[model samples]
Target chain A: MDKGRIFAYLITIIACTLYLLPLYTMVNVSLKSPEDLIWGPVAPARRLYFNSYLQAWEKISEPFFNSIKMTVPATLISTFLGSISGLGFYRAKFKYKDLLLFLIVLGFYVPPQAVLIPLVKFLADIGLYSTIAGLVLTHVAYGMPITTLLFKNYYESIPKEILDSAEVDGASLTTLYRSILLPLSLPGFAVVSIFQFTNIWNEFLFALVLGRGRASQLVTVAIANLKGTTLAAWNVQMAGAVIGAIPVAIFYIFATKLVIKGLMAGAIKG
Target chain B: MARYGNLQIFLFILPATVLVGIFVYAFSAWNVSISLTDWRGLVTSIRFVGLENYLKLINDPIAQKALINTFLLAVTFIPLTMLIGLITAILLCLELKGTSIFRTIFLLPLSFSFVISATMWTWMFSPEQGTINSLLRLLHLDFLCQPWITSTEQSLWCILLVYIWQFSGYVTIIYYSGIRSIPQEHIEAAEIDGASRFNIYRHIIVPQLKGETIGVLTILLFYALRVFDLVYLLTGGGPALSSEVLATYMYRMTFNQNLFAYGASIGTVIFIIALAIMIPFLLLSRRR
Candidate 1:
């Protein structure tokens, strides 16, 4: 009601619109006929149309499944590995432990460009090139640093006394991890798994290079290919993008709190 | 009681250590050696060229353009995103009605993959039928509509716009937390000293966000260095290679042109730049 409050509301409205416009346009065009897209991207659809979605889905279904195949294994492997490594770094006492963790985490920041050349060559040499397995390996390897960081930080907040008592109960290393750390890590698992699933599902670079052809192509690359093959069919192209984004977008919208928690945890720890 | 011996700890860490060592560090070293050669195509042969690729890269016009474009994108993008993010954070930090809704909407773009965002933005920036131009025309602001990604002059800027839209929300979250963490006593004391709301923020609030700014800048600089998906998907580094950054350009050289060694050299350049940006930041953060 007051001046400042009114000013804040006005800016909020404008910023929300700015944020949502492209998404609105994409959805609008995606529901329109090709003839309607020619009219412009801003206009709302005059008639409901599902043909573009159907066509896009039909073309992209294989790669969509491919993404799932790649993403599931990659997410599981990375999260599991990250958990163990995170636990290792947290519980282990040694000289240069901080330095070692620092080195591991530093890999998260390496530009994919820096390693693309050798990665491709190495994959070829090992005969994993152009396979979904290779793509999984690539994501798992790259996923290690961040996941480890996340789990390490997560485990750090657990009381040292809990671990000491678990040891007092005569638990060995494996039993402690199994009986104590693993159970305590369930929530961390939820956060990291969702985080890793969303990321691995949405990743493009490894999918592009390691899995190029139809047999191995990822949804992201498939969508790009759809754009190329359907240059003038804006409606269908938008449909394909929407389809490719559906899984992660759903995660973001429904599990926003978890996503935000993971993001903040990662950023703050970094 | 459950504490592992050093060897057990080593075993626990071995999988990640081996994977990262071979896949990340070892591969990086391999890439460096590849850069020093004249390897090309599907040949097993590699001739050691001893910095020839680097020398050529230093003299290459496209590489120079990429360096300049990358520099310009970073210098412009980081500050603008930070400013917008900071302002948004400040507003949302006010805890006004509907602030949560606005926060959700702002962070929504961060969920969309670069591939998806690039696809959507391509339609938004398409000159003939883009949402932006169409909206402008409908509003009788036809003169305001300009060639966006289609023009070499504007393509990079268009990409920059999309990058900001995608990332500013992330920076906002960081700054929002930073703002929230500022001690309440400081603000109350300032207000009691006859400071206006604006001065209270200017003198006490914004200065404390220095740590947040550094974090944001480091992330943004790294993003700038490794930008490929957006540029490649949105513009393909083109309108005559005008929007090319090192990543896309290196991708084109290696994959498209099959100039393996040449592309590796460019990759090394990017690696060095990343190191240059990251090493100091790491040391600084550690000191803090």
Candidate 2:
């Protein structure tokens, strides 16, 4: 009721409205036909046109599959590898430990563009270039820093006494990790998964350059290509945009808390 | 006593280390090498041309334009987004009703791909029958109706506007989390001392949120420096290279014009600039 509250409320409404504008435009554009799109503010010839959605769906389905093939395995592998390394760093004392940790952390800062050409050549030499496996490998490499950081922080938060107790029980490292560490780290896993899922789902450049063929192209590249091909069809492009964005939106809707937590953790710790 | 665990740590780290080493560090080295050579088209001949490519980059008009546009975009977007983000975060930290809903709604933009967001905005900014133009017409502000993305003068600002809209919420979530983590006792004690809300925030909260501010600013700076996706999708850095940023311009040089070495040089410059800015910020934050 006070001016402060009123001002906050007004700002909140404006911010939310600005945030929602593009989504509103996407939905409205998707509903309109090509003619309506070009005519500008004209009355729609019909309530809805399903053709654009159909076309977008048909065009992007293959790339959607390609994205899944590349993203899922890469996410799983990166999370698994990151967790193991995090546990090792936390539990085991090692020479060059600081250096290794620093190197892993440094991965977060290296610009992807810097490595694009060499990665292309490396993959090409190994006959993996333009393949889903190559795409997945590149993603995993790029993804490790944050994933390792997340798991390391999560493991650090765990009590050292628990691991000592497990050691006292004569449990081997592998057994302890499998039974105790992994189970205790489920929230961290979820957090990492959400981060990796959104990141890989939205990734564009590697998918664009590395996955050149229809066989390996991901949804982002597919949608980008659609933009080029459907230059005049605004409705179709909007439909494609909506389709390309849906998976990420769905993932965020389900795991919003975990994603936000993961992001905050990374930001704070970094 | 735990010295032998070094081997264990090495084994555990091997996969990630090797992957990053090969793809990141090694690849970066290769990118730098390629930039120094005259590699053309799909041709594999890579002959070192000393600093010729770098010299060319300094003089190339379009490359200069791209560098200017990139810095312009960063300078414009980073501070504006941070201010918006700080305000939103402060509001959310008030623990108002529906705060959870507000959190979720605000962070939703982070989940959407920049490509999709940019494409959708492009349509909304279209010259003919675009939503922006239609709205202007409705409000009898016919003078405001213009091609938002196509005009050379307006395109970069238009792109910056979209970037701000897409990222403000993301930065808000970061700041919100940061603000929440600030101990409540500080605020409460300040209040008990008869401190006004603004004074409490200014004197207490802002200083406490320094780490979060640095982290958010650094991420935004990196993003602004290397921005490509939205510009690529929205304008392809054109209506005459008006909206071109360094990354998109690099892509254009190599892919569009087959000036591979020139593009690589531009990319190398971008990397160096990013490093120069980030390393100092990181060191300063670490010192703090």
Candidate 3:
């Protein structure tokens, strides 16, 4: 009934429409039949159609699985490594400990271009160039800085007195972490794993240079190539993009709280 | 506890120290060395050129355009995103019904990969079959149907538009949570003093969102510096390298042309600039 409330609604509606327009076009066109192609992207699909999905799946499936094969191992290995290292940085006392952690965390901001040439050469020298394993290694290595920071931040949130008491009991490092830190770590694991999974899944540059071969190609690269392969077939291209986006999209939707938590924890100072 | 020792810390951090040390830091130093060479191809062709590439890069027209475009994108993008994000956050805090649903919808785009965004937006910006031009025609506004990515003039701005679309929602989310976290006492007290809502916000609320703005700007500046995929896929820095930023142009020089040293120089430029901006910010965060 008020003037400002009406304006607020109008603003919200306009913003949402702009955000959703491209998504609507992609979905609408991907579901159109060849005969319905004449209607253009402005219209909704004339009828339900699934052939584009099938065709797109056929082209992108192998690389989709390749993404999975690489991302899963990289996420697990990186998160596990980051946890212990986070604990190390949290508990360690040394002359240059802060300086060392500062250097490690600073790597998170290094432009990938700065490391690309040598990463490719390093992988090639080890005979792992253009391999899925090489990509997994790249992801894990790149994944270290943030994962360590996130878990270190997470572990620090556990009160010092709780860990102090555990230390008073004569428990060793491994035992304290096993019995105490791991249980308290479930939320941290959720946030860190989601962060790593979405990052590695969506990554393009590393996959482009390091995993260009068919045997190790990532889904992002495949979807990009799908455009060139099906150059005129907009339907197949949109469908392939939808498929490429599904995993990360699902994570953002279903685990939004954790995703935002990860984004904040990764980017902002805690 | 001292029994745990420095050895314990080093042992626990071994994997990260080694992996990040070699993969991130050492590789960066190696990249810097390669920039000092003229190793276009063949291992035997390698020769130390020593800043030849940097001198040439300074003179290069395309690199100059890219530097200008980067400054253009950053100068436009950062402020616009923050302004829009701040406004959206304020509107969401108005406590209308179903605000959570609106928040969720706004964030949906952030989930998409740039590859997906490129694919989708390329379709949306297609000259003949695009959503914008088509919708324009439907409204009988054919005069407004301008060439988007194909026109050299429009190409850079189009990339800027997409960058804003993908990122503003992220800034909004950070700001929304930030606004919610501000204690209610100040606003309540301001209202009791007969201050208008706008005045209350202008004087009391906006000033306190500094941390959120800094955090959001750090992320946005990083994207502005390293943006490649969308520009690479959407326009391929095309219509005469009109939309070329340093990343895509550097990629082409190195990978496509095999001008390894030239590209390495460009990469170093990006890295050095990033460090210059980021180091102070990192120190600030550490001090906090």
lDDT of 2: 0.80
Candidate 3 - CAPRI tier?
A: medium
B139 in model 3: Cα distance from truth in Å? Answer: 1.7
User: Which structure is stronger by TM-score: 2 or 3?
Assistant: 3
Q: What is the lDDT of residue A268 in candidate 1?
A: 49
- Which residue pairs overlap in candidate 2's backbone? A40-B129
Fnat for each predicted structure, in order: 0.68, 0.54, 0.70
Which 10 consecutive positions of candidate 2 chain B have the poorest summed lDDT? B1-10
lDDT, candidate 3, at B117: 87
Q: What lDDT would each prediction earn against the true structure?
A: 0.87, 0.80, 0.87
Q: Model 3 over residues B166-235: C-alpha lDDT tens digits?
A: 8888888899998899999988999999999789889988899888878898788778767788888888
Name the 10 consecutive residues with the lowest summed lDDT in model 2 chain A. Answer: A37-46
Deviation from native of the Cα of residue B164 in model 1, angstroms:
0.2
Predicted candidate 1 versus true structure: per-residue lDDT over B32-89, tens digit per residue: 9999999999888779999999999999999999999988888888889888888889
Model 3 iRMSD vs. native: 1.5
RMSD of each: 1.6, 2.4, 1.4
For model 2, what is the alpha-carbon lDDT of residue A150? 79
Error of 1 at A44 (Å): 0.7
